[model samples]
Every structure is written in C-alpha cells, then in structure tokens.
Target: MTNATRISATLPPDLAAFLDEYQETHHLSSRSAALAEAVRALRDQNLQEAYQELGEAQRSGQETYPDDNLDGLENE
Candidate 1:
C-alpha cells in the first residue's frame, strides 16, 4: 500500500447504498476497499468461467485452447 491513487466516480443510488452497506458489514475502512473487493470477486468469477470452459473443451475433445490471457473464444 505504499503507492495509491485517488479517483472520482458516480454510481446509481442502489449501487451506492449497497457499497455503503457492504463496507459497514464487512468492516472495510472505506467504500474504496469495498469496491476493490467487488472488482476482485468479478475477476475471480471470470477466471473460474474460463477454466471451466477449458476443462469442458478438453473433456469433449474439441482440441481448442483458451487464449493466453484466458479470454477464450469470443463467438462461443
């Protein structure tokens, strides 16, 4: 946490309220921490989906591979 940057953002009322509630419930120091956790969760979800797809392709003998960055095929 030696380096940090500040940015401004706007959110819908519902989303803003959710962040506030999540911060308080999780005992996060700030809404920024809550938002960071949300983003990390999303990244984890995307990775999980990509790995599932890769496993499925392997099981089905599709012989296709996911991209290096795990973006997978766009047309699927």
Candidate 2:
C-alpha cells in the first residue's frame, strides 16, 4: 500500500454539506478517501492532456523518429 498523509482544510457550508451527503450516499469511509479519489482523477486528466499534446506535436513534425530499423512489410 502507498503511504498516506493527513491534511485539514475548511470548506463553505454548502460544500461541506455536499461532501457529507456524498459520503453517506456512497458509503465512503471518510473525507480523506473521497478527496484522495478526487485527486487521483485530476492526475489522470493531467496525464491525458500531456499525451494529447505529445500527439499533436508529433503530427505537426515538431517531433521526429529515426528510421534505424528498415523492416520490410507487404501492404495489402
């Protein structure tokens, strides 16, 4: 298991209430679990954006690949 860290923050009444309701509805153990999941989701989004940018750069010829292995294949 990965190491865990504890953090504390204050939220507005409405946000606090929403989180409470979400925990009850989803049966989450604690706020930390919910927040951790949220952070993981955000990280995934960032990684996806980075991958998209790399693809765009490659398409625009801003990136290059050397053809070191000249393998022959028949195109049907």
- Whose TM-score is greatest here? 1
TM of each candidate vs. truth: 0.77, 0.68
TM-score of 2: 0.68
Candidate 1 per-residue lDDT, tens place, 1-76, comes to 3465787889999999999999999999999899889977897798788789879998998977736554634523
lDDT of each candidate versus the true structure: 0.83, 0.70
Q: Give the per-residue lDDT digits (tens) of candidate 2, residues 1-75.
A: 167677787989998788788777888898877766666678778767767876788899885434662222222
> What ranges in model 1 sit over 4 Å off?
66-76
